[model samples]
Target: MTDRDSVFLRALGDAASRLRPEVHEYVAGPPAGSRSGVGRGVFEIAGSPYRRIAGLLRIVSGPDVALDAYERDVPFEIVNRLAADGSRPRLDAERSFRFRRGPRRFVDTLQVGRIPGTLVNTPGTDGRVELLLECSVTADGNLMMQSRAARVRIGRRRIRLPKLVSVKVTVIDGWSPEHEHRTVDVSVRNPVLGTVLRYRGWFPYEYVPS
Candidate 1:
């Protein structure tokens, strides 16, 4: 691993160390090539682990503008407005996040549902299992959504699902607080993964992986 990779690994290890012991079990390596040219590293926290807590922590300690490319991957501006004015916008619950990063346009919608407050590893019909989460928005407009820290046994089975991942929003509106939300969306293929903004309009986005 290069120096940059070492720093990213250390960050991931440090973040994992701060979580509950059980939550650590579900933590996995950041997907191969998940780290783009602009990001320092990409890390993945399983949905099982995410449903345990209500906040997300984006480790952005290395390079400046390390997460610039990821802003288009999440729905930050809309969430910030809701948390700031205490006004709940008419969430489509079906509307997906749509944004542009360079020449690419990414879009994905989550199937929202109230998950029962129960712990069980049930197989999903679409091959993607749903997990409950207590999502919390921070004052700075960053989302810190975590999962219930518990051990889930998969019994040697491999599954593919779009897990809720963290995005760091940069432009916090004046009405927003200083704390950022470790926000996550259900889409996982976007090359950008941590950029955050304060508006819904398109902007020139770029990232240089450290």
Candidate 2:
């Protein structure tokens, strides 16, 4: 559907208007056949056998809400603005996430709500293990995920685990000379296991017909 005919697109346009103007530059998709750079994520799974199992299940399930948004063809600008800063990855008040990622899948943040509180996931696949996270933004505008109240789901079964795991995602946005300004750093760790996955890079992207 055209952006003008879709209420979802209209709301996204409105929300983007409220954000920092510089963000608009990133919202617009990259040109065709551009070099969407690389990003890295570090994941560690350690603690009890339960923690290990929970982490594994998380990897298998992948990102829930964020993937859904992408499948729905949500605009990149709206999702980028909501996910870029440390705010919860909410699409709107009643909706779950504020923004969506491009088709190239270069996005690092995912929005998976948890009732009154919010749950955001940043999933990374860096050749080795698939790092999955559930976190929130800090007052300092950083992405953070705590292992406390963390859980794993395999189909209908859900397994809740301890709080010994966490992830910190640091994003650095800069003019790439080639693709304006865009860069990000992500790290995930378990006190018992250390660093498991890490990536630092960027992706050049452009929005196609939805």
Candidate 3:
């Protein structure tokens, strides 16, 4: 990774740490159905806290690192525009984003002009999965910021796993200065492993031992 990339990644990491609460607060509001002045519903009362806690964990622990690292490869022009004159840069928009697992692709649209978050998927020994969702934000009256929780899904696998599996992430758009890869120490029981085999520009290939 270039020095520029490193700087961008660090900046993004810092920004993510600060944006956690804003993302959580935005996600905590009631969905479209609950505002009709209907009688107090079980979901309205019981589900509100659950949603709040879940959003908190998600914001606190989600995939901020990877996303920030990816952003480092973006062109300086875009970065400057995104950063503007602010102390921290926010995600202006997420376009052509796709998460891939083998031949399968999970396609989704991440709304524009929102704080970025992180999502880490680790497999467990009992065949379940752990997902750490995190967000970042700046604290009140402080230059520094901290990451907080929006939600945590323990022992839940949204996608089923094969005996032999690997994770592949691709950034179709946007830019950052740093190479988008990291060496992670995964458990022996984990079906997948993260390794760096090759890199170009700002993206790194995470090789999984076959």
Cα-based lDDT for every prediction: 0.24, 0.33, 0.24
Candidate 3: tens digits of C-alpha lDDT, residues 59-106: 433432112112112221111012122443222211121212111111
Q: What is candidate 1's lDDT per residue for 1-210, written digit by digit as tens?
A: 222221112223334334332122212212244332111111121111221121221121111111223343333221100011132111111112332433211211122223432112211122223232333333443323333321222445533323334232222111211232122333212124432222232211122232
* TM-scores of all predicted structures: 0.21, 0.39, 0.18
| Weakest ten-residue segment in model 1 by summed lDDT | 76-85
Cα RMSD to the true fold for all candidates: 19.1, 12.6, 19.2
Clashes of 2: 29
**Poorest stretch of ten by lDDT in candidate 3:** 38-47
TM-score of candidate 3 against the unseen true structure: 0.18
What tens-digit string does per-residue lDDT give for candidate 2 at 51-125? 235446346444331122212222222133232235422222111222233232233334444432333343433
Question: Evaluated with TM-score, which candidate comes out highest?
Answer: 2
